[model samples]
Target: MTNFVTKESLFELQSITNPVLAPNEQEALFIRTQMNEKENNYNAHLFHIELASGHLTQWTFGNERISSPAWSPNGKLVAFLVKRGEKQQLYLLNSRGGEAQELTTLPNGVNSFLWSPCGEKIWLTTSVKEGLAITDEEEKEDKKFPKAYVVDKMKYKADSLGLLPQNRHAQIAVVELSSKEVTAYTDAPYSHSLQGISHDGKTLVVAVNRVDNTDDVFRTPLYLVDVDTKEEIMLIEEDGYYGDAAFSFDDRYIAFGGSDQTFKNATHGHVYIYDTQSKNRQKLTEMFDVPVGDYAVGDTQQAASAPTVMWTENNDLYFQVSTEGDVRLYYATLEGAIYPASPENEHVYGYAIFKNGNRALMTVSNPTFPGELFDFDITTGERKQLTTFNAEFLANTTLSTPEAIVYPTKDGFTVHGWIMKPANYIAGEKYPLIVEVHGGPHTLYANTFFHEMQLLAAQGYGVLYVNPRGSHGYSQSFVDAVRGDYGGGDYEDIMAGLDYALANYDWIDEARLGLTGGSYGGFMTNWAVGHTTRFKAAVTQRSISNWISFNGVSDIGYYFTEWQMLADMNNVEKLWHHSPLKYAANVETPLLILHSERDFRCPIEQAEQLYITLKRMGKEVAFVRFPESDHNLSRTGIPSLRVERLAQITGWFIKYL
Candidate 1:
């Protein structure tokens, strides 16, 4: 059969995510997202793929968006959240396949929900009533506060469910499976818990961020509550954000990750094991490295959000470590003993540790291959390749293999990067170079198989990507070097890598240089053009132009900006001095700005500001806005739109370079 490639074909490729192995370990259930080009919406369905037979079947069907498939302990029934009309309601389905039964008639909507260990109850976090104010007249008349107007956080920024104010915080609710009754648990009118529940059903841990009118952003503290007695205890309190706590199998200690902010600078995260009985917290890992390459983790030198922590049957702690340019699994004991289970390989993105503990099911990818699941034996370090998701597609395509390179920055610090040569290239032929900047200023670029880099290489462009000062996988000091000096040494590190490529590789065309990046990478691209005219063309996606404006606009703008730059919005002059928009007059390179209209993390206004400025100055500039995309447009948006985005970006480079 001839392979058909089209705009529709781009949308036809379905994505499988959040794979959870069933209790029997014979089947895996995950969320499969299908993109409908006609509607420009993604339809997510729950699917169960048989491990032994390679049989794939869809379990959920309908117009509703179904996600977060959680199997019960018995593996007979699965619980998931479905968006019906305007509200997201909880539903239960038979593991085999059948019509799902609705569990909640919540008026507002459920944000997140999980099942109890014994499958006796369901815990959910949701926003119920609109909002209420403490009024003097209503308090005196009926001893009840008057209802206030509902403020939806998702309205202004189309991509996010905005941060609800103190008056409209989300509350936790527990629904007993037998009684079919729901009870509110710790409904604070002024604060909201980030995460809920322990491994055992006895205690509930919450990350509470107190809201006040003042600009002072208080830290998120971990609070423990006894399920039966309803007694809440403060477990861990520090001067930073903390959440994503995983309980040990015996429930003796709780492992959590947190970062500290001193002055305006934020430190990398440190994993801590908290003893519930003694009320003591011990630091587990001091510097857990963030993986380079994949942007799954946000820009942080420390471990990714929700540090992958699991307790083995042998009382050993198993977690993923992404230090040293590759992602690897590491085993640690409560007594601070740590070792790698499979330290031989350089790349391991996704993993699942079974309750059986003899083997670990994982999805491994390398520089040439996309991703394939494998069953790795813990005893012998043997691996068996399982599913070949895109084997045929890969066989038909000409993929590029990245070579890792290191070069010294002007400041004497060595920076790491991966370079991809043009596919089927002639020995002496020179090719145009594309400098791909990764998104997280804190994220690293590793030697993993990247579709975009391979596509660019197929198009006859040599792709060069580098992990600058702020990138992870490096030491904490190197990652922190980019903080408060965004465009300084990071720029030098990128330039040094480019210089190394030009000096070492004779087949690189320096005159035809092109640059592109999203998020922080986009910010650096915008900054790059303003500082130098080295690149012939550039594309900046979801970029930040004005730090001063970004501080007030973004979801984590207030705290993140302060944490990154060590400066608040009050330092407007300092922020603008570092902003790319301030140097727009010196920008000579042709630029293309791509932005998601609903992006709350970076906000579309940042893109608009740069586009309008460059166009008004009579420079070659174009702006493309994705209507319903979030900050994760490339990763999780409409499939066709993602292809179009790539086409537009490459097209811009083709036209200029």
Candidate 2:
């Protein structure tokens, strides 16, 4: 007998990421991430899938975590990153057999690395202080007697990496595989990212901002350094953010994905090719309306970073595009013609192209299951399931399939959304509806397996999620429309989607409607309840309550508020005009505020402000805080805490809705 998906069953699911085809093309290497329910954390290890035999092999063991597995060009060794003490360093393991060996022990550790074409050396990026090379002992001593942080730069704190070192910047380095000797290439004050080495391994490319006194993080230029001489040459000097670069097979052109920041953060990322000889750049994705990266947000697992561009030997550029909530692979020719490289209705999170250009190893997820590896035949359009990581769990579990719907707003503008039916549906029975908003007012709710939505469906509630105007899967104008006017059209888009569902679906209980969202979605939930009493209950997570305080508190609030809301602390009236806290007394729905204690993006103080204001106003509100959690608590936080969060959301709706 099949069973409905339960929170406990979350441990049964596995995550597959970073699929890279072996140089021989007979197998592929990927990281398998699994949750240890007993320990309440996640463990990831390296694994390889055999193409012809359909066999899976675990290349690493123990409880230690590892990631970013790269196969050497010569197919002799596989190098990956493993954490030791305070830093993550590179480790090498023989392809045939033997235990892995540590390659380098840099001070701050390696962030990312790439194997050279000859497999004789590995290029990497590591952080270092501008003039001070602090040793391990000094690093330990500083922790014993902590000093005050001297503030200098505008970009001090990041969401994931936390507080940045005063003068530390990421620099490029190379390690000779044979001698195990490391050499620093460039020493600069600005942070640099290691893109890749040329085909002949003589020239290296790194993305950085050498332009003076510019605080914009989105605008970066590409720089090429002679591997032996260490001489740096600027390639393209356009005022745009550029990374995910790859040199053409013949070393003539370099393809990268970026946006010119026309609309700031909401701009669509396009594919651009730079001619090495002429230093001229041409846009390759001018006609492709969708953004050139994965923007589908979910709570099922930790998201994987996909390459911005994958190049074939023939200079065929393949990349992923987020469109209408689903991520699809596309290949483009030099002349600007583009076509789909993967099937429809499937989210291709990450992919690695085989040298033959006809096959690719992809990490694919659909409505039915979590991510898994599959061998895709580009020519024949044949896909073979390479790994069955979630086969057992999926076989015993029953899930609801979402029905895609395209509806119009009050202004007749079309919007895309999905409605997931209750797991055990009947003909005439009415079911309660839950409207879920995604966090990135710029993100999408797509055709992927969302664990929270599935769990809600299992509990007899219909789940509805939509992509508003500011989402990335649409045109450039649509995404930019939500920048200055947050609560106007974007709010109507969500309400119109709910209206369409209630009008079209007779089995929905309009009186028992509930709303929930995180980040931007959380902000929307707060705005919706204050603006209207239609929703009976609501849950807001990691949300913003006051734009005034948000500008001062959030890590990205200073610039993000100016960019998204078109207002800063200087504009007090405009900032408070969009703040949900300003209208707290108007809230009629029972609201549940969930927030992470350490979330710097939308700090927990935002939740506190909302809870106290609603309580002072004698409104129905409750606050729940998770300690040591950040903005990503729902997705990559502590495993046990994630499960409890799902329970809290489910229980709140069950009691009120």
- Using Cα atoms with residue i matched to residue i, what is each candidate's TM-score against the true structure? 0.87, 0.97
Task: State the C-alpha lDDT per candidate.
Answer: 0.73, 0.86
lDDT of 2 by residue, 1-657 (tens): 999988776788888888988888888888888888876777789997778998888999876678788899888899999974469999999999899999988888899998888888898888887775522322444566878877666667766557866667788777898888877766778878887678888887888886545545557777787877878787666666777778888999888888876888898989988888897789899887789888888766554767899888888889999987789999888889898888888788889988657888899998877989888899999998888889998989999999999997776568999998999989899999999999888888877888888899999999899899998788888888899887889999999999999999999999999999999999999999989999999999999989999987888988899999998878989988998998898999999999998898998899999999999989989999998889999889988988889889999999997
Q: After the best TM-score superposition of candidate 2, give how far the Cα of residue 265 lies from its true spot, in angstroms.
A: 0.6
For model 1, give the 10-residue run with minimal summed lDDT: 298-307
Worst ten in a row by lDDT for model 2 = 132-141
lDDT tens string, model 1, 1-657? 323222233453444445677888887776656666676666777777787776877787766678677788788889988986667888888887678888877666677787887798888887644343211112132437655645443222324554343335577777778776778875566455535467668888876666544246557777887878978788777776666677877788887666666423325555678887898888777545442123333210111122356666666776666665676777777888777786533566666677656677666666676555677888798987666556666556666678888787777678878888887678889899999998777666665556677677877889999888887776667878888898888888888888899999999999999999999999999999999999999999999999998987887787778778878877877788779999999999999999998898999999999998999999889999998688987766666678888899879988998
Q: Candidate 2 — which residues are off by over 4 angstroms?
A: 84-86, 133-137, 142-144, 211-217
lDDT of 2 at 331: 87
Pairs that collide in candidate 1 are 153-162, 293-444, 293-445, 293-446
Q: Taking the candidates one at a time, how many backbone clashes does each contain?
A: 4, 0
